[model samples]
Target: MSETAPTPAPAPKRRSTFLRDLVIIVVAALLASFLVKAYLVRSFWIPSGSMENTLMINDRVLVNELVPKVAPLRRGDVIVFRDPGGWLGPGMGDDLVKRVIGLPGDTVACCDARGRLSVNGHAVDEPYVVLSRGSDRVVRDDFSVTVPAGALWVMGDNRYDSADSRVHGTVPEADVVGRAFVITWPAGRWSVLSRYGDEWDGVPAP
Candidate 1:
């Protein structure tokens, strides 16, 4: 009686190994991306022109959520955070991006003689403020406020159009989502987002 020819060796061992290895590679890649998104960095889409010139609408940005863990949040950090209040309409959205103008316990004011936002008595040179190209204007109405303990005063690069901390008040430090570190979309606009921290140097600590 002829046997069943060993049933074609029950499928090749090599084929099984190849499939298993492929699965492992795929799973490993998926896991790496998840970890990076969870702890290292996260990508966000700009929904408005609030950060115009510096960050335009639809520009995708990469925020380093790892920053607060690595270093203290400081002035000039371009950050994303949950809405402090009316800044975001009901059910419209929550996350907003702005440059930190005031740290906890710091005072933020607008348009010092040269019309730049000043933080804690230091007159910062704000070259990032963008006015419609031909306008060359930079004052966004005079206002002053002190950032309460454990809160941050944030503003957009496009001051006039942005509804930020100046509108809804300071965001709790805990509400900060991350520090935006790069603009990753629109090839022509791709560049590392820089913080004006150097200018904060020598500025008195709050």
Candidate 2:
């Protein structure tokens, strides 16, 4: 009866791996963040008042890199791009943000009696344009130009103050980095950027 075999040695205890699992999770999260920043979205801060009430100076925005690549651009979509040469002067940054005013082959003009910008001969209701500091006008310049193929005419909500396509000329589509889709910083300023498609509803194709 006392011949019971010696108790088998206690099975070896498995070591806890919480730290290993945690490290793996952290690494994976970081990698995913890096990938998103590199190919899906990126953050940029407003360096000036070009976008105004829409994007104030120092506002942080999230730009979707898929746009104008996976998604075609639309008039009124805010975008970020490299300066198309001579657009930026000394001390100015190479990258800038503006709203699409004209697509390739579209004619863009300013002030249609009612102070509205016109696209393809149709007046657009630009509720976003800010009135000049001391005047009732929104746009300070009166000009017209047809956007060339593979280029886009852009402008700012602060029309009178922005040095945009009006001052520098159309930006090549190739120079666009992405479309800015949202304001992410300054919790009070959080909002989705609008394409203002309705403003272009009456605009005819060019």
Candidate 3:
């Protein structure tokens, strides 16, 4: 074969062409985020002090919108769920986040002689709860609830200040929209949310 000429290098892209490519890249990124928000995870605005000491009002968190499909719900997982029945105002549709205290068929009660919560007659130690003034081991209030089938009993970390499942009763497990996996706002407070792994993980499923 005859010697072939060296192939010429491709021409440089025009400035306008470079800009168009950048626009496409930005649009693709935006679309990816939009899809995540709609189908996988979404950011939520904390609207109240219900979960204080662990999550503050106005702090932001990312919720796995498809949690029900990914894994089974467990005790101590922080979950966000829609207003179950009268939990919200008439016609209002909103979600609330709280730690799961009881699973379906579990009996959750407050304050044993040592001031700890009991599940199925076994006392559970909660190191994250707010304490009574000057008493480090005290958990406030006295209430007992047996979670119904297909429901969950939830409570905020700020025991004395929250109006959670303790107030309106157990919420339908079907109403759980997602599990909050992280705090995304207030960079100083940014961190992954963790459940009571070694502490309560061994509790039998109801």
Q: What is candidate 3's TM-score against the reference?
A: 0.82
| Local distance difference test, candidate 1 | 0.82
- Candidate models: Cα lDDT each: 0.82, 0.88, 0.84
Counting clashing residue pairs in each candidate, in order, gives 0, 0, 0
Winner on lDDT between 1 and 2 is: 2
- Over 119-160, each residue of candidate 3 has an lDDT whose tens digit, in order, gives 887788888788768764435667788888988889888887
**Model 1: worst 10 consecutive residues (lDDT sum):** 131-140
lDDT of 2 by residue, 1-206 (tens): 57777886534432236667788999999999999999989999899997888999999999999988899998999999998889878988889999998999999887777777889999888888888766655587688899999999998998868988877888999999999999999999999999888886668999
Ranking by TM-score: 2, 1, 3
Best by TM-score: 2
Predicted candidate 3: what Cα RMSD to the true structure?
A: 4.3
Q: After superposition, how far is residue 197 of candidate 3 from its true place, in Å?
A: 0.8
Q: In lDDT terms, how accurate is model 3?
A: 0.84
Ranking by lDDT: 2, 3, 1
> Best candidate, lDDT-wise?
2
What are the runs in model 1 whose C-alpha is more than 4 Å off? Answer: 1-22, 132-138
Sequence-dependent TM-score of model 1: 0.83
Task: Report residue 20 deviation for candidate 2 (angstroms).
Answer: 5.8
